[model samples]
Target: MTDHHPDPAAPQPGAAAPQSACPADWDPLASQRRPEDPPLDVLLSGTVFFDIVFTGLDRLPEPGEELWSKGLGSSPGGIANLAVAAARLGLRTGLVAGFGDDAYADWMWHTMSEEEGIDLSASKRFPDFHSALTCSIAAQGDRAMVTHGHDSPEPMSRLVQHAPAARAAVVDLAGETDWWGRFTSGDTKVFADIGFDETGRWDPADLAPLAHCHAFTPNAVEAMNYTRTESPDRAVRAIAELVPLAVVTDGVDGSYAIDQTTGEEAFCPAVPVTAIDTTGAGDVFAAALVLGTLAEWPLEQRLKFGSLCSALAVQQFGGSLAAPGWGDIVDWWGSLSTAAQAGDLRAGYTRGPYMFLDDIVPDHPVQGRRRAQGTFAMRSDAGHH
Candidate 1:
């Protein structure tokens, strides 16, 4: 596809490359579609935030002090992060959430439905309400966020009287359970994650939702806290007893998984990269893991794919926009392969983890995709930055 985001101020090369007018779509589950299957591959529901990220900050401003940032990006965040990640990877994603009748809401609605191809049929827009907004500061290898907004007038559980059928649903364990029962009933699989417990209760009873879930993905700290285990490996194993599949993500070191349903256990190392911003890396990882699960890939392969996707996401800024498309994956693999062939030992070692993509990625050239505008500036005004 033609770059949706073009840098006009940059000097043009002597010979510009031809752009793809018609971006080719690569559906990883194209072979599995049936006439009776659900129209949506994945269903998601949560709050949507208009995220403004400030990067290149030496540090956050001190009290009553001011600082300048070198970079800025704007995009839809929260549930939109997972939605964009899944949609970019070719999943027929449907989102159910609340929105406001404001400019931020308008931009986000357009970006997700028109640009990202996410279905918003089940979502609603409330007049007179302001959309949630978050300002994030990235510095010193981590980020901090300040948000402002009220809860949706209507809870998602109440808004979703009847959840539509889907192959899979991604949900948080802390949400209401009334609507979840109807959605998790038949062939639909539920993948659950949990938020940090601010109360420090770390109570196992809070995780009762796992009884109905097919898989659970949690960070290493979350797993250890809930399972009372000291290490990620033990935490995953403990969690596997509750859900058929358990995945614990350990930043930098990688991820660990235990799939009791398939009788498999494995660990996948993280792909090393200089992270520019890590806004929605977990959402990307969850999306990739869901894709692998639906495609019936082995446990280890799924972890590796998820880790690779997360790695790519952290290299960019815009939370939802940072999600990588198939073209990004293909380009990354091609570049690594070329480097390895040219005697780059590091590329060779790094490529060994994703060798499985050889059989899965499409052989034909597909469109390359990246994040949208770094800022919400008009196209003609973008060059000023």
Candidate 2:
């Protein structure tokens, strides 16, 4: 793994410097819209956590040693990572999760519903429940986290019952949630993901939910262990037998995917970028894949898009908020194309792989999107307390 961290002298919150303002809004799906289509593009339900991320750590502290991290950030995490990622990519996203009445919950609610423009019509606020919180120690492109929170007072089935209809939904098969069946019944395509099995059992029954899913995305290790395959290629093929679309993401090596729906299989290489923090790179990848799939793009392009988005995400710090918007995509492509034209060998190879993006990215100017903040203070509450 690449050993890299943010510069210690950088800003405290989010660790990275402030990003430029991105376009207020841009809908990539406008061209494919139909009058009868669902109001939301993606539906998600899970716990939302107030994440406190510490970056620039040289190493984990020894038992008796104390270490001061050079960077810090605060944002909504857990399911919110996927939610913000999809929304930033111009998907009309809705979230069904429980929230608390505390300050942390209030900040996350404002960030997701107001700042991020995610739909929270189905989410509920408990009277005194405290919002979930995670403290992430980031170093060497990976992280260790300590989280404190409780399960939603109400079952996810209860919250999802009121969720808006959508074209697709992202489900964690590990959650063993029963609501995806209801979604599939309504013609919503389900994209499933599985969490690491700490039990090491790697039981096949854990994947029973794939029967209702349109696609399944798992990391290389998880896929290999679950399928008992020797390699990601074999794992993806085996997984495809269970779900129409099987995606195995190998960090830095890129992603491999097989789409039985399109009779296409492809491997997209990871875009090389200096590592900062890889907190939510996987979520970013899944969001990009969902966008490409919903748009009816070719399977190869879908993998490539997902790889590129995740690459962009890891170049920054934080999780949910670090996800790139279209403006970020535009900037990355523009820089690459310029470098390629100027005879940069590596840039040429990278730009050529994503040549498909030439036709899809917006040609006109677009605003830069929101960046991760160090604090949860909302402008509306400013000067009031």
Candidate 3:
């Protein structure tokens, strides 16, 4: 497992002068696309969970009563969803995670590293430990899940040790602050989100990461709790003071964001979709946020794109596998025409991102066997093998 240990040289926020803008040298690819020289656009660190999902069940199983699910499938879940979401959106994404060399881990790692095009150069493997597992059951409009696993051998903060200089990083709020400083020192945009606080403490210190994060996205409750504010707008304002851009997402009411750069705020209603399962919607929401910010689009446009993406994600069964890609977005837009708009927001939102559609080539490997089974071994704990 990747160690959560801090890198001795990891820069601390405010310890040095702000990272300078683009350096003197100039290569079109290096200067513009990869400002940080990171081989990938985003390098993420989180736990990898093997998910077993059961869908299409009309109701939850009664105590000891037999139940039949209409569908059953499996996929890589947990923070893996964020990595897959970014990759599907055309971002060169990498993930630093830990894995046990069990059957579930083998399949999950192969599916993510091979099928998804995510760079797992910083990931580590423990042949003896049992990989994490999540069993999810979907019934009616809701779902229940139970996860089993031990903590990763290392904390997620250690990813910076092995990852290249990425333009942005997706991380949790309570995670290591040192990585935030190190990443930002190279002009890497750190996008941070907070986890649920069952204790309801919602410490203001949790927002400490915002000091280094280029953007901070928290759900309505998380934002409100952290800010001690009642409304999403207030929460956004309080947070905007700390970060360049602050977003507070409210389920059906929509999402609110304040762009400190422009002093502009915007809100977009959630796309009303017959949700099948909302397992990975939040992660999908964060993915759109990352892209919209990177593309320098308007706050309203970013919110709309995120809303649509999350709305689409829940319409499928599995977690990360349910993430919608550009292909899915275009298809959903095409389907909207027949629905006659009906206030579902069919236009404007798709134009900016959709314009680049022609450039992406579908991931269809022509010849049989894209790589060898031993290919997973190519990645060494020594870093970026």
Candidate 4:
């Protein structure tokens, strides 16, 4: 794909490298389509978890110690983070997930389908099953989490028959094999993510899904641990050999990605922001990455946009609600000085053999540039910060 974002001032030795063209009929802000909806921009499949988060912890608690938190909020989490993020960014997004008949499931379905405008026609509500639960304890820049729930045998788990058609899908590398075949119809793209192997398995066989994926994203730790590499750069390079694109996100430091197809690489510097809770920042990043790719953006723009999205999510509480929309992005953009908006914000990991990035904040020419409109509509009734 050709880079939608071009830097006129820079000297790109081989910027002449071929890139894919933008999608023929994609529009960022057209009216949202409903049932028998047009093909979706992105589709996601994973178990939906009800997230309960606690913040303001001085340190992790001892086994016998009681802990008190200064903040608390709950929302649908797990892959729901990506779903909401994609919807808020104005992608025609859909999800194939499973839930239970309990109140938690009802709330999740309502929040996703009604509030966030995500398509869940392919989702299932299990009468006998209970939705998954995640307890997040956030401190410093990272969070520790514990999850509990049994696997749902519902149809959503088996995605081959239930998943809706979309241009791309975000799925776990360990997910069912059939999903790999089901979603990649015509020109569909598959973006793969990974889950931790508690058993220390980290088996190569787990990477089977990569065979069908166009890109793979993993956190620094997950990337290093899975690839047995010492750093995120080496891991990304190693994984790129398996797929057309590879990215490894290092929290606070920034992120790195390589498009083997175009021989284009970028190491984006994270925008400086005070983080409140980082429970689902990775999911937010992945969602934004999916959006940038669907828009056929330059590799640098894609990474920078993902970093900004993840940074914004960390500033808010709750999982899905924390995912920022176009309004939030524009609001942040409006806060920057003209130079900051037009020049590169060099505040993150910098060592690499790739081109330096300028225009860390992208332009908003086609969409209305009203700074006041940056307040996202998906915010809660209280207008959560």
Question: Against the true structure, whose lDDT is highest?
Answer: 2
Clashes of 3: 4
| Candidate 4 ranges with C-alpha deviation above 4 Å | 1-38, 140-144, 155-160, 338-385
TM-score of every model?
0.91, 0.91, 0.79, 0.77
Residue 228 alpha-carbon offset, candidate 3, angstroms? 1.5
Q: In model 3, which residue pairs have backbone atoms overlapping below 3 Å?
A: 2-154, 3-154, 4-155, 38-165
Instruction: Compose the digit string of candidate 1's lDDT tens values, residues 205-320.
Output: 98888989999999999999999999999999999999999999998989999998889999988998999988889999999999999999999999999999999899888888
- Model 3, span 1-385: residue lDDT tens: 1112111221222121112211101111222464436566777887888888888898988778988887876778888889877766666677788888887787667666655556676677876888899888888877778889998777656755866667788888765555556676667888889889988888897676577678888999999989999999999989899999889899878999999887779988888778877888999999888877777777887888889889978877677877876556656655554354444455544344444333322323111111112223322221121
Give the local distance difference test score of model 4.
0.68
Query: What overall lDDT goes with each candidate model?
Result: 0.81, 0.82, 0.69, 0.68
Residue-level lDDT of model 4, residues 188-287, one tens digit each, is: 7889988777888677777766877899998888888888899989989888988898999998888989998778998987867888877678888998
TM-score of 1: 0.91
RMSD of every prediction = 6.3, 7.0, 9.8, 10.1
Model 1 pairs in collision: none
Clashes of each: 0, 6, 4, 5
Off by over 4 Å in 2: 1-24, 380-385
Local distance difference test, candidate 3: 0.69
Q: Please state the error at residue 334 of candidate 2 in Å.
A: 1.1
